[model samples]
Target chain A: MLKKETYINGFSSINPIKDSGNEEDVFRCVEPDYKTYIDTIAVRRLGKIQRMALVGAKMCLENAGVNLPDAIITGTGLGCLSDTEKFLGNMLDDESGLHSPTSFIQSTHNTISGQIAIMLKCYGYNNTYSHRGLSFERALEDASLLLLENTENVMIGAVDEIPDSTLKITQKVKTFYSKSHRNEPVAGEGVHYFLLSNAKQPNSILLKEFSSIEGKVSYEEILLECKRILLSAGIETREVDALILGTNPNIDELHYQQLQNELFLNSNVLQFKNLTGESFTASGFGVVLACKFLLGQTLDERMYLKKKHSKAQTVLIYNQFKGISHSFFLLQNV
Target chain B: MPSKVYVTGLGIISAMGVGVSETLRSFSTEKTFVRHPEILKTLLKEQYPLGEVRFSNEELKSLLKINSKQSFSRTSLLALIAAKEALFSSRQKESPLGIGVISGTSVGGMDKGEYLYDGYIRKNGKFNLHDAFVHDCGDSTNKIVSYLGTQAYSTTISTACSSAANAIMLGARLIKAGKLQRVIAGGTDALTRFTLSGFRSLMILSDEYCKPFDQNRKGLNLGEGAGYIVLESEEILNKENRKPICELTGYANTCDAFHQTASSPDGNGAWLAISQALALAGLNAEEISYVNTHGTATPNNDLSESMAMKRVFGEKMPPFSSTKSFTGHTLGAAGGIEAVFSALSIRDKIIFPNLHFQDKMEETGIQPTTDFKKEVEIKHVLSNSFGFGGNNSSLVFSAC
Candidate 1:
């Protein structure tokens, strides 16, 4: 069977920072016009995750010039946190009486994916992956598989929301650091979306290959596997110009440092967790940052973990959620 | 050119039985698993019927020999049981040959969460935070992967009822694309109060046995179960010199985008998914020997699925039935269970009956096969699973 090539045609994202409008305006962090896309009625009903996802999805579709996608796939770690927290809190506060069903319904992990399908009127494949940090990467893998099978247009994304209860839980669990260390710590809400296609466009980036690694595999073994994959793709180690790392100042710095000191010692390393915070699906944001870097776009200095390298050809995005699920994607500028 | 994906082994655990043989026997005997809930200790047990598996959480944990001390949710236990059976049935001695496990789950650890919610809030619960770890839908898949002791390419798919079918689809894609040699694909979801009450709130849980495609169908009876299949690339199967039970001929997933919780009146997503699956299989609708309809016995589902069946199969639809009557609506696990059942049907050359059906649906002239059938030359089987948010999926199985 002949393999079909897949490419990332367009991408869009919405974060706490003002990043959705022009490519140059991503550095600006200002309040968005949430009322413009969402009305008071809908806003009151939606959880933070849903609202961010809807806006990000809309931006992605509009940017991709795709009116209706053939499939909608989403990934999140803790889905609809606001709703889940609300429902759980109500159960705790009011002893479960007088509890509305709306929060419970929205709390299901697949609600966002279902909502996207409903919003797009797209009667195609819809799925959501919620495997901690690798959630979005898994969704991307699914989209790539569909595109490889000749499915034309796919809308894929990852979204996470910062709910007060969840934030408290994270703090309790030590998943988040103090707010004073905001420069290097804590998780925040954001959504990143991509329109994928098999046919390459002038402005598109080619997805060369992707793989998910699990369990206690040695870093050397992972590097060897990555080397084999790159070799199969007819590329060499030194040919790779940049590596995008999903690093968090508080939690992931040790692992990022190990990666930097070990396998990526020779390559130009860049990190993005500072800009997007440490959400479970923030790796998807890392993918967006890699694409922006490959496109010769500048990012906010706050997100930079290492010096910027000029003229990167091949970029590798490596992300893992809490050291459980690891994913690596090799991307190249077209 | 399209790649061929083969189904090598199947494992299932439902109210009917623990393995494929028991499930098949129950199906042949026209035995229905629907009864008054005994396993789920809920106040509504007396008022509603459920498809509960007769196993305690401790018994399940002991059966699977998980010693994490952290309480395993019913969903994780069921998934581990089914996944272990799948790997064992595959007869593979290798630790990991680039094998992956993709399981679908809707309510991950809600069972445990609901049980310990108050205690955790009060800070006096015996619940380990790690016990609450499984609450995320994906954690169930992670637990399954850990239980199997194999880590290659594993992930979880959550599309509600269509989840396992999507898992199967992804597994097949990975093999066809030469990404992985083998994958354990399926779904597991245990019934929980969260889900039961959610369904009750929606008024979709029937108080009696479900009647799919029946004119008087009220709603579906919820059940809990897990099913998984071992899928391998042709190259791997050929190298191993193994006989495949069935070939995964085609699969497709489509979203209705019609409603958040209801299928479209026209079954647009169902129609597209079925049509796409058949087209990928390179077979006409008439070639389908049987269809495991996603007939949850819900009024909306039966009507919408019937319309979609008519649109796809036209006037000459094949023998179709909803096994949900036997296993109840397992939500994310339904697709996996039905996929295993479809493979069994092809292997045994038998058609399982739709347990509770009295009359034909008025919206469509579709009547499911109500009697057990045997010794038929089954060639192709199609299965449909649609879920909340209009997510729809269809899979085709053929004799190898």
Candidate 2:
């Protein structure tokens, strides 16, 4: 937990979901017009992940009414996979010939955050995390530390891109599948960024607490962890207006189902991957949705698992990836 | 006041050697390990000089007692070896939970991914399960965690070459923040055709041994290895009654925001990182006894770093040297390996020399210590690591 108060001042996301009205499995980002944010010549060289991240970062700052942040931290699991594969393929094919430096340069994981700093010309603290499921959480943890140290604003983002080849391999190999259960989630990717601030703004939502643990965790352990997180935030289970569970079309909905039926029985249970699909940093989309729900956005009917007679003031997001990396976030309307 | 971060143990494996003692012997004997690739099978093995680890994957697996059937990347294997030593050296009467593991790497499992890519992508060949897994950067960190038998919070940072420096910085912060009592922090990278080819394409790799801070210096020799240090909080140090090797006084990270691959001529980012780190340590320029430079021996880096050092210390510059000459530039592992070297310098009161130094550069007229010295009253050591994406990091280790 942070010693000082931190709030989500602004947030933006570019996802693959075509629309929220239907349950469609969109695997890539429904990109925005890049020329609006990035110039034409520059856009040609930028990869899909880079362009989406740049635009999302720009929109996040604009929404927060801030020009430059005190720090830029980003998280990406695969990190410009298209460029990485491109460079690797080019090298394998050519063997001895000269290879272009552009693909190699952009293939680095930090390029996302580095480019953001370059664009802003803000040379403050810059960091990038590439952990599997905890990438976004690690970046957030760093931002929380900065906030406690009195940093005013921090621009943080989590992005991952799945190339067609990568998607095909993982799908064919049943990488996402558990031996005992079926995998129902489509492989998806996107870029989600947020402007976290120590000071409260008009549209700010209080980021109460967030924590994560990695191991071969059990369902009971996750249940206890969620309760502990809620306890630390000084909120009772009944007070949680909505419980945002990171459930995809996975056959092993046992964890989510048991948590809903036992722990937060009175709260409205919801899912976000229906619109955003499942990826390493898909919990980032859940975070954005929590912020929106705190700000009184009407609950999307497509996201509901169980609707209760409660308002959307307090939201607790619980995400467990492959039963290995488990995390949670608590937000409140302030 | 924030808690003080102490270096409790050290582990390193490079062309220098496998453990701390071997590494020290190499430094004291002044034996340069630059040679052709013997362990890493590559088309450019004989074409370019490298600092390859003198062990094959099978040998490494047997040494570490890992089942050969389990497919672990060279990156994970190297990390496990180093991290295991660190954990063993740092153990007290009882092991504890909440020991965070933070690792840095540029190419996580590319050593394995490069070979499997063709088979998986083209569908013309069979994919071996052992080589198929452990491709991401986090895989190495996870391997370290499971091997150490600690249910700890772990993560991986990939900021190119400066990765291990940033990892060390983050570990210190976590200790200071009272988040974790003990943390294993460093970086690991394995040589692969992908990196060799990338540098070859850039036309920066030197055919000869690297000559850092030298006038007619060629580029750096690519090296492969892992380096790690166990950091403990003040409270843990008191409870465990363990002697600290040194104190991590300060660390700072900054981006040049200038270019992706090349640093600015003025070295603005390096300057900021150095000055800020000094300010945090509450030390003056004269208080620093030695510096471990991020001198990849590249034409641009040595010159840019020289300008930054001049701007920071002026005429009162400390005796600085680039150990990359001995270990070769281990890329992400350079920072971790150099940090261990800095701690060793403080612990033993000795300074490692820059190998193959001939002439001072004309641009800055800076000269590094060319001979190994012993019995020096070393106190504070500043180590710099600059990488691609304009990432610059400097760490200050003080004698405790």
Candidate 3:
């Protein structure tokens, strides 16, 4: 029910998959050379977490052809986990009151976005969303509101770091899978950023609609919300060229698959968790993939379960985790 | 057409007390709860004083009837306590038009996360993933969802101290934009050694009672608690014949873009935010009856905020005071708690005193309410909440 149309100008995704040097069946990001993007001063002051955030944000700005953004918004579940772990380890080891300010400064969830703004000298509006799965979507929603308010350009970044200690604790419960032990969903980390505007461009993808629902939602309710998003976009269910589901790949959880079959039965369905791995803000990578497919107008069969559609005019991203926060996004080629 | 947003209900739990009546009762008297914390499990207990909430985790769980064994963070516990009070007091727990939640938190469940970190360092073979789940910023929000029943939207904001103010702004925007008819917007934060040590590393923790807007102000004392406000559209208010606590007329957020930790000396961001907030409310500098300042007593903040107030109000500055003198700086929850206090001022027609203010700073001519006193005919109250990363926000509440 928005009166404005948000455009996806430029974006960058730095995860295990992209950072992966070779094409392995497993997912991981082969990181870009940080030495090239960041200067020596920042390199010495920042940690790995801040380095990735800076690189990812700079890539998007360069691609978008903008120097200073009007606003900077970010979404992260556990921000700068490695630095946080370092700080906490000192406290537990009885070595208190002895440490550098770098770890402590970067440990905050807002550090990613704040640091980015500081680097760019952007005095504009800045915010960060720290919700679990809904973090990225919330940031996007805030951007949409800004666009509606006539703010020209906004930058949204979704970044979360996974530390070894965190992985050890969660994997003990079998919540996350390992690369060698491939049956379960593995934990992932990435710095995904986007530059957006209200006006349409030649290569812009129309962010037609984005919606999220939470609390006491039933499977039927999720299906209904999906239908509402498509309906609001003036697109028929059968007309959707591809269905990109953000699933955790749990074979027991047939709810998403069953709902997809009943709704968009003929559309080619695909999943992204295999390539992007799993993080709280993985939806950023998902939406970026959808936009890339819409812009490229082609798909690589390896990333898809059903390879019926070769060209995607419109792509729908359906994502939910543990049946908690469910979100639907509709993207179309402009 | 967009409808006006109203504050139908408010719930707050701080070091002062629980529930609105208790907080108001404590506020009415000459009692302010600033002391060495008896509750927070910090190793620096002998070093820094705080305004920590008194209830234990078990006591809070019993009050809500939630099982003690459940993986509930202390942050979530405080949030649930305050949120439940707002819901029941607003009588909108079962709003048919759907309710959204926009809660703010800086560290989420870091208090619990710190213990898990201890396990990781000590090489403790036993590890519980439940603690990992509780550490997420959204975990407390999801818990509230299960307790609050059906909701249309849910999200968490983490912009340090300005978080709750931003949450309240978003809730009002949603209602005005007709995206959501009702919302529970505010923030909650719990104290932890991780945060306390971080502040200590930054050397911003004061050893004595925090003095706001005073000449001899040293630094800030970190506190913990949760505060929330129930926002409803005019249609819902009319449908239920509910009286509003105050009209949330204007709100704005602007960043200093200066430093990560220190505020700019010119107070440019703070002035922009306060001016923009006034513009949104369609009020002038002279109409503001009271100003609840974001005075953390830290030298940098008090000076910058004073300059910003001068820039906006010129020579006719309204009587302003920092309630933080009563409640130690609550970080992300400061905005929410201060907004509640601002509403209370409008509802009670009184301006609460700023405690421990002996001398005013030499910068220009600004003085806090030197004594605990009450005032009449207060129409509108402006509250300021500034945070690190230059994330500053201001809110205006007016009587209906």
Candidate 4:
């Protein structure tokens, strides 16, 4: 292994919030002036997910002060659902095998990365992973490897959208459906992008480890993986100041709570999925929130689970989907 | 020094047939498998020819000994069939240093999802909600990993047609990073009404057999199948006491950054990928013995790829062919199956011909090999796979 230290130079996320005291703003992104990042003409043709990804990518690059990166990689678990729903509805209504290609084109999983590539004219390594919860982790893994292999700069993003139709289907499903708990984490959308570089910059956040375990992993398995990562980084479990847990009372909250209690006992554990909701790439939203917490920012009252810890140095963000797969990531202030 | 990744085993199932021998037989016998699909329940079946795997979903499950009680999508079944062959051919009994699986799929379990969603939307009948949730891209990877009875890090890549090549590239990267000693990396996709309609809407589907690099080429015939290659670190190959099929020496993925659905006229992405892969392998363009071009036979792709080839090789181009003319355009699995063909080229020293070719494009004037089978002294082979959104990837394979 090259064991090269990777750093996040810049980050941006266009995510949905649960409340705005208004109906239209309830489920939409309140961050990023889309018009500032996207042109007037092009903005009309792009969908919400597309526009969010473009704005997030541009903001990431601008924050890093780099015009173009060596690569643009992205992950989307529920890929362009609004456009896909439109296309599918058209197909269902008219089975003539003919329709406008615009919706169909935007519905592809690679459309986000490809759109970024087109916007930046970045003719470098580009890829998109759509493997459920592992989507963003795969993007992160690829970005890290690129840095390790001497690629100077890479942009990694993860985005998921819940169109009304798709959200209806998700709500009908048993896992995401929770009529009893109104404030529970549910289907929300987000687009998160980070600029990663091989060279460290001032105030850059060091990415220590990003790992995932899939398919019916036990509690011990999760603990062992966490131990391996911490051991490899020469950091003790007691040294971790804050832990980010993917806890949702509606679904899959107990697993994370158990993990926190078993492995990260007495740490200032935090909750992110509560605010980000249950999108497949909610891990991205969680990690971004962790980055915020690690940057010496005070916590929002809703975000802090236990009492806030003072003088934080390292944080761990762990998330899983329906308890079938688990992802563990460790980050340190640099 | 960076670690070396070796291709120890390969398995494939396509319109050509099942297993490696069947695919090789199609190559040797020059068989045409594109026809009206019996498996894909699409309304456009009569309007377009497809490269559908011969076996039906139930028959495939039976072949894999999967019980009827458990639901398996056509994509997962095809993936399992091909992956089992790959693991067997790898000849490793257990994972001593841990293993992983990285699969690529353009449409994972969409065939099943389309049916179930129709039931839910139309309220036609009771749909299995459980199956609906499993219709994700990662679901196919999880199913195949479980079938192999191993607990390894698994993920799915969905970069459209360049997906499998990207999967192979990631696998090689992991091995080089010492993340794992052995990995099964490939791609699988089944013919679905969603993709058939989507491609149909794109208006790129051909009504006839695809002809690569032909001046009168119409378009590509969409294909469905699975192809997997077991890539292990050199340490594993040495420990297992098995001969490697080939060495995965070079890979590069570059985006055209030109258009969403069309390749750039300059072929910037393809040229950069080819040049970079050659550079990474520490070889010159002239040293590539054979080239497996991503010749989907589409007018835009053939011209762009030909221009890229001309840019990379100039007048010193080696024998090259697009196997898609034989197996149709296998989308996500194209890279995996093409890599298999590239390794077979290095192992057998034979060049599979591009099936239909009468005239070359006027601008490039680069002609693909048209003979049925051309025996050659091959050592290294380069393969190309390009997808929509201008994603282009190239891989280089060499003899052990």
Best candidate, DockQ: 2
Better of 3 and 4 by lDDT: 4
- The interface root-mean-square deviations, each candidate in sequence, come to 2.9, 1.1, 1.8, 1.4
Query: Model 3, A86-115: lDDT tens per residue?
Result: 888876665356456667777778777877
lDDT of 1 by residue, A1-334 (tens): 1246777888887766544432321122233466766553744676666766777777787877778888788988877767766676655564424456787778777889888776666766788987776788788878877776668998898788766555644554556655543333556677889999987788788888777766556667666766766777788766777778876655644555666666665677777765566677877777788788788887776665666457677888777665655677788988
| Model 1 regions lying over 4 Å from their true place | A1-5, A18-31, A35-44, A87-101, A178-185, A222-242, A261-269, A308-314, B1-3, B93-97, B122-126
Question: What digit string (tens of lDDT, one per residue) describes model 4 on residues A69-129?
Answer: 9999898887777877777777767766588878888887899999989988899999998
Q: What are the runs in model 2 whose C-alpha is more than 4 Å off?
A: A20-26, A177-184, A298-300
Q: Show pairs that collide, candidate 1.
A: A123-B255, A124-B254, A124-B255, A125-B254
Q: What does fnat come to for each candidate?
A: 0.61, 0.62, 0.58, 0.69
Best by lDDT: 2
Model 2 chain A, TM-score vs. native:
0.94
Ranking by TM-score: 2, 4, 3, 1
Worst 10 residues of 4 chain A by lDDT: A18-27
Q: Which lDDT tens digits does candidate 1 get at residues B1-101?
A: 54578998888999887888788777766878878888887767787788888888888888887766775789989998888888888887577545798
- Pairs that clash in candidate 2: none
Candidate 1: Cα lDDT at A22: 28
**Candidate 3 TM-score, true structure as reference:** 0.94
The residue ranges of model 3 lying beyond 4 angstroms of the native Cα positions read A18-28, A95-98, A178-183, A215-219, A248-253, A259-268, A297-301, B93-97
- Global fold similarity of model 1 (TM-score): 0.91
TM-score of each prediction: 0.91, 0.97, 0.94, 0.95
